[model samples]
Target: MKDRGHVSTTQTLDLNDAGKIIDAGIAEAERIGNPSNIAGVDAGGCLLAFARMDDAWRGSVDIAISKAWTARAFDVETKALAKLAQPGADFYGIHASNDGKVMIFAGGVPIKEGETVIGAVGVSGGTGKQDQGVAEAAAQAFARG
Candidate 1:
């Protein structure tokens, strides 16, 4: 018998799997010709691995990681959060206090396994749509396994 709210579940991505996710993100970025910065983080919002492609903006590396952290911590697309942060929103300044580490943009997505969110992926240095596309590709790669 399990206690209510204490159900045991398995982790979607282990340390080894996290490495695979990073590799998938890199490959997807190359495929898209974006060559941007990509980052993957665990449920705890800790960075698992990251990469900055050639010609990528140096600052995008940090931005990608921050976006991943925000998505994982909040369990929603960073872009959606950005929408809520628009002028006159009740939580506008809330997302801004992360010290430039929380990017509420369209480049972050939560990694999920059968309805359980286990991590998040973020990409930057490209257009907002391009970033989201790359992140989605990476997430799909993980999901296929």
Candidate 2:
């Protein structure tokens, strides 16, 4: 028998990790004094976990989840997709074509470890920049762990 070197693999986010991401997002929202809704989803666009602040807008829950779904499904930030809707772009209808799962707006970011996409986190119920900030904070939290 020949000896073989050890193989290494990258870490990926599963359902439990996705839940942690959602928690981090909620915490970020609180820290920023922006009560909002947050959601996490797996790479396949399946919902892993979600949270809505006590005073968050009722509709933000659905929007946050949809944002996460969109990011996971596309493997990119929803904001980037939103940018593709420029006047001459061919994807102008993409935002409305995902059957309500695609929210082509800021606030959704994919959770990636190197090239491996684990899942995504999304925040809503604030300005676009505020939402993006919350999502970024959550992503940073997940990366730290």
Candidate 3:
């Protein structure tokens, strides 16, 4: 019988990892002067940890969760997904799907282990660019550790 390769191990994030991501995001958001809501999700697209900075917009909490879920669900940066989800694009109207849990905008970044997406980080409460910057920093910190 022919042998198959060993089953690949899955990468998962724990609460500690989530804390790291959230801390990095908070740091970036503070530096940018954009108090923000940040979220982290595990490989299964389940919420792991979340943080809302003081004075952050209350409305952004849901946005942050949705963004994280969307990133892990689709395994792509939401900023890049925004383009695909644009009118006349492949993913047009996607935001209207997923029971409205899809956030087709910046601020969501998938955390990867090699070529595999293990989790995601999301931020909200500022301009799209500011949120995106915070999310990226959060994910990068996880990637480095």
What are the clash counts of all predictions, listed in order?
Answer: 0, 0, 0
Candidate 1: C-alpha RMSD to true structure equals 3.0
lDDT of 2: 0.84
lDDT of 1 at 32: 81
lDDT of 1 by residue, 11-55 (tens): 645666566776787787788888888888887888888888899
Stretches of candidate 3 exceeding 4 Å from the true structure:
1-9
Q: Output the TM-score of candidate 1.
A: 0.85
Cα shift from native, residue 27, model 1 (Å): 2.5
The local distance difference test score of each candidate is 0.82, 0.84, 0.94
List, residue by residue over 22-57, the lDDT tens digit for candidate 3: 999999998989999999999999999999999999
After TM-score superposition, the amount by which residue 28's alpha carbon in candidate 2 deviates from its true location, in angstroms, is: 1.8
- Which prediction has the highest lDDT against the true structure? 3
Global Cα RMSD, each model:
3.0, 3.9, 3.0
